[model samples]
Target: MKRFHVHVVVPKLDESVRFYSSMFGANPTVLKDDYAKWMLEDPRVNFAISARGGEAGVNHLGFQVDSEEELTALREQVVAGSVEIQDQPGAQCCYAASDKYWTQDPAGVPWETYHTLGDIPLFGADSHEKTVAGASSACCAPAVSIPAVVQRKVGCG
Candidate 1:
């Protein structure tokens, strides 16, 4: 089965990890000083965090497979194109699962290829885990706050 992958670079790896852990109900399966990741199965996605160049958010995104057989097939396909396999499957990781691999597109963006036979618990989309509150900042500030009553009056009720 085909699945989506998204990698985001963040300023604070720990905050991002906590944010996603609360949002997705799964902690990073793999984490290090420079990187951390969540292999979430319910929605079939791989979320990656990286600390490089001081940049933050969405490094790349692609597909994640479901089995070793699937990974092998994709590895062959990737190798045939003369692309070196960055990370092979079966490598030890931190949180839920045990193995994963990494690949890259022609543009040099990284895409994670992995399978989590051991599933992790997931949260609903509307879970309080997510930070919907936009923070005040220089580049972008939060919009005017409205009371629940005003929200209801505006048909957002």
Candidate 2:
């Protein structure tokens, strides 16, 4: 099984939490100082919001798979279609460890497909690591472009 995922960056955590909770008719399943997540069964979506001081609006969209096999199948589909992707295996982000593949849609919206492995105490375990291009890694999302070497290593175009 897979759940549709949507992450948004907000300016105010408390206000956004209040608004979303009222709209969803339930409180978030996971709430932190700067983040909140609602695992909504009604819409079968994993909707999350954060106040991380970034640009406000949709942060990213994704599919959260239940198992590694499902993740692999999704990855294979992306590869078969020859889409450019950034693969992050054993990534710890959004308070969870996951294996993820990221790609941009035709309109340039970023999308992620991942399988969660477990929870983590931090928002992102490797938040400080520099990418192959020497740019600081974004906490929950990949940079716009991955280095060719990394793309080759991940077997993604």
For each of the candidates, give the backbone clash count.
3, 0
Which candidate should be chosen as best, given lDDT against the real structure? 2
TM-score of 1: 0.46
| lDDT over C-alpha atoms for residue 6 of model 2 | 98
RMSD (CA, Å), candidate 2 to true, equals 5.6
* lDDT per residue as tens, model 1, 1-157: 8678776768887787888899998878777775677767788777777665335656556566767888778777766766654443333332234245455555556555666555323211112211124322111111222111111223554
Question: TM-scores of all models?
Answer: 0.46, 0.87
Local accuracy of candidate 2 as per-residue lDDT tens digits, 51-152: 987899999899999999999999888877767777788888889988888877766688889998999998878866434355677877766563222133
Regions of candidate 1 where Cα sits further than 4 Å from its true position: 12-44, 47-54, 117-157
Candidate 2: lDDT of 31? 99
Q: For residue 66, what is the lDDT in candidate 2?
A: 93
